[model samples]
Target: MIQIVPIDTPTLGDRSYLVGDGTVAFVVDPQRDIDRVLDLAARHGLRITDVFETHIHNDYVTGGLALARATGAAYHVNAADPVSFDRTPIRDHDVVEVGERMRVRAVATPGHTFTHLSYVLETPDRAPVVFTGGSLLFGSTGRPDLLGPSHTDELVRAQYASAHRLTGGLPDDTEICPTHGFGSFCSATQSEAERSTIGREKQVNPVLTQDEESYVEQLLAGLDAFPAYYAHMGPANTAGPAAVDLAEPRTADPAELRARIDAGEWVVDLRSRTAFAAGHLAGSLNFGLDGSFATYLGWLIPWGTPVSLLGDTPEQVAEAQRELVRIGIDRIESSATGEPEAWSGAAPLGTFPRASFTDLAAVRHHRAVTVLDVRRDSEWAGKHVDGAVHVPLHDLLHRLDEVPRGEVWVHCKSGYRASIGASVLAAAGHRVVVIDDQFDQAENAGLPMTA
Candidate 1:
């Protein structure tokens, strides 16, 4: 009997699977969290024999090579543009044996990227299961526009043919598993249901409903703004990820934390920005403990840096620690164990004042405040508060000098980014106020607008 284990890619909300028969296992599209897969293998007393990358991912880094390196397992990818790091290059019809009862056959599926492929898992008693990387999603399909214009048409045509190959050629009952799910940038249209059957998708998926051209047109129409950081992620994945060292859980006194920070160690405040802005130790960088925390941390902090975590509670600290470990960032020295007591010994960095739209209006009338909008440029263009400076959150770190130090008012669509911006400015000794709400209220009130 074969068992399928689904592991959630916390950052991207994507799913990577581990397939095994209680003796040897195979992992598919292993994300940056290689430890979890290892742990799962250990729990089942199974040895991981293969690590496969269905396609090069853009949203989060892939951990296929890392897992293979750690476990001495073989890493697999398409023969064309074969993954560079000590991997077995697999081509169409290439067979990889897992155990006596299971085998995986590579099937070429190009559309999302120039060299995409899927795996068909053959089991003893059941129909084959297709691991459709980005080719065919639950409700929609992978976008063809990701590949550069030179090969866009060819790739799109290949994608359509690939979809037909799987749906028409494979058994109707073949289980379909995808790399991405709803809310992923990879798939233009994704169903809320993460996994489905080929027959079910053929019957209900709109993209599969139409011919190639119509599908491609619809995909191009609804793409959200891909984050600037995503451009760096894909290439890094192709090259293989650097090893991350996890810090052991140690109870640190406030003096120890301060000494470490004073010694040039990086401190990551893992609480929500709002909580961090409420009151935090001076000089801690704010990246909320929400989605993409590990990804941004990897970018911001150098590998093997002696880092400390500050969370809202003990539970939150543990959660943050586990997330960091998933991405191989294990070098956490210690976490602040208690709240006010934990912070009382440390110097107050500064406070980010909370403001409502009414407060913002009052400040605007005074002419003494500098309003900073930290939402995206497109969001700023949609509408904005009068006399507010446009500085998107991602760029705020680099453009801090552009914001005036006196009486800074930071805001975003809601209060989230504003809170992060406020925390950053406060750490820099700027008097900051984070407007928690009242954007819509202020708009309804017909407050003045500048640009």
Candidate 2:
């Protein structure tokens, strides 16, 4: 009996699979942190024999090369990919046996990337399972535009063909284990379903249900901005990423923290949005641990900028470090784990007002305040508060000059991005009030909205 274990990195919305039939195992799409994989294999009493990557990833750094080297396992990647590191270049239709119970066959599924391959794992007693990396997702396919707009049309059409190719050969009950679409921006759309099969996807997935032209049109229209840091992931993965260092960073004193902030380096606070809004070190930005910490930080921060961390606990700092390393932000210049007072030194902690859409509506009745909407372009185009200044959170730092100087009320679809935006504004010496409420409440609050 083969046991397949999904090692989920929920923070990034990706899953790495570990499959074994008691004695030997293989891994697929492992994250930068390979200790989790090592520990899992140890616990399962299985020796890893192979590591596979479906494509050169563009979201987070790949752990395949490092893991394969560590365990002396054969590292499998697409033969045609222009990677710098040594790898077992497996081509389409190639089959490799893993122990006595399992065999994996490479199937070309070139929608996410031109070289993308989905692996079909077969066992004697059970239905086959396909590890669809960025190819076929649960309800949607991987976004085809990640390689830039030039290849989007070509890839979308290929993506459509790939979905059909997989279903054409596989049984209806073939389990679908995908690498993206949990919450990863790599997916064309987010999916709520936890588990699915080829049969289920045939009944619902856009790539499977719609004609190629229709699917292509809808997919191209729906893509919003992916993380800016994605520009660096592919190159790093192709060159072979180093083993991540999860060690707690060197501790910085309050004065050092202030120095880093004054030098225009990012000093991130990994607390809850509410806690950060209530009191935080002045000039420090909030990309709270409670939300998509790595995603937003990676998206917003100027690439290659020095970063320092302020968390309430060592564990928080450690978690933040793990998240940062996955995105190739390896060096955390320093970190401090303590309260706002301690990090504030002799200075007072800064704070901002947090209110709901009802309060915003009421304020609009009497006075003028800069209403800033920091959602993505698609979101802003769909519906937005009337008379709101639009600036997607990713572009906020560079476009700060466009933000009119005044009492600014910042908001996003949810309050999370709003708090981060508010912190950015407050750090720039603008008076900011975070609209700490859902955007859906705007209608109930009688705030006028425009499409």
Give a tens-digit lDDT track for model 1, residues 1-451: 8998988764665789999998999999987667888999999888999988888876667778888889989889776764557678888889999878889999888778878889999998888898888888887777776655587678777788888887887888999988876566667665778568998988987667888788767666655444444565667777878655444477777788778877868777887766676767777767787646765565445456787887777787777776665445556787775563465474655456687888777666668788888877667777887777888777776788999878888888767667767777776678888888746666765568645
Against the true structure, candidate 2 reaches a TM-score of: 0.99
- The residue-by-residue lDDT of candidate 2 on 25-62, one tens digit each, is 99999999999999999999999999999999999999
Candidate 1 similarity to native, TM-score: 0.79
Question: lDDT of each model, Cα atoms only?
Answer: 0.76, 0.95
- For candidate 1, the per-residue lDDT at 186 reads 69
Give TM-scores for every candidate, taking all chains together and pairing residue i with residue i: 0.79, 0.99
* Weakest 10 consecutive residues of candidate 1 by summed lDDT: 221-230
